[model samples]
Target: MHQYQFSLVFFTVLTQWALGSILMISLYRAATGGQELNNSKLTAIALWLICGFGSLCSLAHLGNPLQGYYALRGLGSSWMSREVIVFGGINGLTTLWLLTHLVKGKENLQQTLGLITGVCGLAAITMTGQIYYAVEHQPSWHTPLTHIGFVSTALLLGLATLALVLRQSSKEMPAGFRALLTASVVMVFAVTWQLAQITGLELNGVLVWYRVFASLMVGCGLLVMAKSLNLHSTAMVGLAVLLMVSGEIAGRMGFYGSVLGKMPW
Candidate 1:
């Protein structure tokens, strides 16, 4: 379905924030504590590439790139301003950390940076959700639960995708890959539970979209578990990737479609 341009733009902004935040933390987790996670660096590198490209595209959508420098002016009054700040800071910090890891060949410092990236990345998406959550006039967007929903969707999708991509490169993987799969599936369930609670509140179209999206997310998790149980890690990971895409896309659509007029403003 067609969406208003700005609405599409806003959705993209939040997506970029969510994906970047999830991956940063995951990479750091792989590398830290001397885990010696094969393909962890590759995941980190992919995080930098995909998320960075999305960010650039986001920036390009801006009409006045230089004016973006003044974006934080509304921090006191605008959630968007806060989003810009978190996005800018975490992106910059993550880049430096990722680069340092590459050139310096890893260190405790990189792990520290990873921690920072994860926290900031999650915050950035939280800020994105708040960008709407603060709109007290919009009931659908006004709930604090929206924040949880946004973050959960991001984590589930990001982790599942990263897990899927990594498993593709090699047959063997960290012992935690299965655990990670479990955690991601749990996240999907959490999101689905929340969506059901919000059902019938959104427009019929939006509600239908959310149900479909939410179901697919849940199913993806189940599929992963099934494959994993059958000792089919490769298939499970591949399906997880598909599941993540469905969940993220459906979530963004649900969010946009749920939007309605301001409360008599």
Candidate 2:
């Protein structure tokens, strides 16, 4: 149970990184496709840091940490195997990213590594959640769309935290702000839908936290937008931060509370 709690925290953080990676690729893809954004470097970096660190924490949960390397040998048969491989790649690339930045971004080696890292980072996050989705026992966990919910929340929290970090960068982010808030709202709705699917699964404490956090997330997003529109950026920031924390707590509780058939709590 304690391990599950730790894993859930790691999973949440990893998923956020995955969301940031997806967003980064999407933005880059869009720009190449003639679409545009008011890109925020600070926001992007913070997301990378938190998500990357979160993914690395999984190493703590490995029962036989040394043998963890051999897990990737099974990728041919399972996504979990690929996740192990990808998480390693994410760490390696993050090391490269740091080195590249230290060298004033002139390292082509780092540049290439960054691209691979970005892809694997998202893959790690997606597959982390997908691990449960692959389980055929727990119907709540077996939902095909659960992976999307995990990915969406990652984007929401990643962007929100990034926005906070960007405030210190002193950069104007009109388009970035709009896009992130919109995504945040969408994430809240998606969470609601997923919870709806699990209405009365005999998981009371877990569902209670899930619904509470889902509602908190949505309510907070709305409040932030409403306040921000009324010339209250401070109020919006406060609301957003509160919602993000509440959402995280809710998510962790739900993850820890729910019992899988493979591992009864």
Candidate 3:
């Protein structure tokens, strides 16, 4: 577990969550006929800030932050290089879209920029997954399941966080949507757990406990979110987000804990 990089855990989860939020927010807007939600602009800004912080965390993972530019040199053959490039694009485009929305107030151009930002976000997240999937020696991470898990993490946290933001802002979401979103979170976790089991990766001691606790926390959070939806309790929604975020962080730690480099026989 000593080799597990906490910076990377934060970087991957935070950036993916930010990217996922953009896509989900776009879908939500389309579904609601572009109805503007209260504080939606604030939400977008907060997400971009999160992505920026995550990008910094990624730099912290490097031995020399100044030398980080060299990572782009391997774009032709390195998943890491591609991931970095895509991440930069996502950050730049999203920031530009945010600025246009705040300053120019051009609805049509904002929509165009949003669409482009969302596409780049999706590409960035996929490339993030590929960074691990390309590790041929690490069989545990070489499966398509790695990509699935990354995307799932994005959606699960993205939707939950988005719901929290909307509810807190006193914005109205479509009826029963929160419950549906929470259910999807549960479903994603179940699928991820099943896939991990199928992989038969060994987990001992604290690692096993981490997995169990993370699952429990996430389950509890989803249940709370579902109940809060029915009760229209904003406080409960906030609590659920807290729980889910904590659980996700723990789950990511467990994921890093499970990494098994090629065993030298």
For each candidate, what is the lDDT? 0.59, 0.56, 0.69
- What 10-residue stretch in candidate 1 is worst by lDDT? 1-10
The whole-model C-alpha lDDT of candidate 1 against the native structure comes to 0.59
Candidate 1 per-residue C-alpha lDDT over 1-265 given as tens digits, one digit per residue, 9 for 90 to 100: 3432344444453455445444534563555453444555665676666566656655665679778778778878887777777767877876776775577655566666766677677777777778777777666668776777667666655555555554555434355655665665565566555654664444435544544554354545454555557755667665655555555655565565556422234
Off by over 4 Å in 2: 1-4, 18-49, 105-120, 199-246, 261-265
Q: Native-vs-model 3 lDDT?
A: 0.69
lDDT value for candidate 2?
0.56
Tell me, by TM-score, which candidate is best. Answer: 3
All-Cα superposition RMSD per candidate = 4.3, 5.0, 3.2
TM-score of 3: 0.84
For model 2, residues 112-216, the per-residue Cα lDDT tens digits are 554566566656667867887887767666775567666666556545544443333433335765576577556756665575457454554554455455435
How do the residues 1-265 of candidate 3 rate in per-residue lDDT, one tens digit apiece?
Answer: 2545789888988887787777777767767777676676777788889889988899998889998989989988999988887787788988887786678556556656766777677777777878888887665577776777677677766676667767766676565566656665666567457656744445533543454455345444553446555755666765665665556666666566557322342
Question: For candidate 2, which ten residues in a row score worst on lDDT?
Answer: 34-43
TM-score of 1: 0.73
Which residue runs of candidate 3 sit more than 4 Å off their true CA positions? 169-172, 175-183, 198-231, 260-265
